[model samples]
Target: MNKVHYLNSHVEKFREDIKITIDVENIGDLTHYCNLHIENKKVTKIFTECFHKKETYKDLIKKLPDTVERLGLFYLTTVYWIAYTCHYHNDKFDEAMGHCLDSIDMDVPLLNSPHFCKKVYYYLNPIDEVKC
Candidate 1:
């Protein structure tokens, strides 16, 4: 499997809410197959609305030092997920993506996107289309 599992808490409310996971092997371009697409307009709209949280990123940035310290064996890999989440709706696409590409090259998964909601139902979220 490309990825043994993927957390789906950000999507539909499954019974085992915390157990929401999708399995796809990490070979070839598995982005679409992995269901990372924010397909549902409702979900996408919700995400678009909530994605603009300077407060949240600021909080995370403040805690980054502590958060990093709390990481263990998978620290490097784990941090990118956060970075990805940040860039998913982040305003600073260029900078965030630079970090994301580096993360992916290092074998870290970046789930964030620069794409718009409508296109998210189709492909990668476009950085230039974020509804500021």
Candidate 2:
């Protein structure tokens, strides 16, 4: 969310429920606002791409930290857009912010990939399960 002006975030962690509050500068001329939601792990409830088994989604969430950590700028940006879209639509703010900060610990990456690369563009349409 480079173009996005990050404002603040709040987290409420309980035994079974984890809620997150994220505030980002809105697109266009809109004022900043907060988007909040609780964490959900349902496979069919998050990713737009379909998986044959629920375990795959679980595994994906499990591996998200390593994946984002290892991602080049291009991929990270891709993920950010997905998260930003999640925030924009307010479908799954927790999942979006979770992936945004790497779910295990809420720490933003200091500096993203520094390699000079071409801008990449991705197009994802909203699906019944996940909104792009």
Give me the candidate number with maximum TM-score: 1
**Clash tally, candidates in order:** 10, 0
Which residue pairs overlap in candidate 1's backbone? 1-25, 2-24, 2-25, 2-26, 3-24, 114-125, 114-126, 114-127, 115-125, 115-126
Clashes by residue pair, model 2: none
* Candidate 1, position 38, lDDT: 23
lDDT of 2 by residue, 8-63 (tens): 33222222342333333322111111121222233213333322132232343443
Please give the lDDT score at residue 33 for candidate 1.
19
Instruction: Kindly report which residue stretches of model 2 are placed more than 4 angstroms away from their true locations once superposed.
Output: 1-76, 79-87, 103-106, 110-132
Per-model CA lDDT versus the true structure: 0.31, 0.33
- Model 1 is weakest, by summed lDDT over 10 consecutive residues, at 24-33
Per-residue lDDT value at 34 in model 2: 15
TM-scores vs. true structure, each candidate: 0.22, 0.22
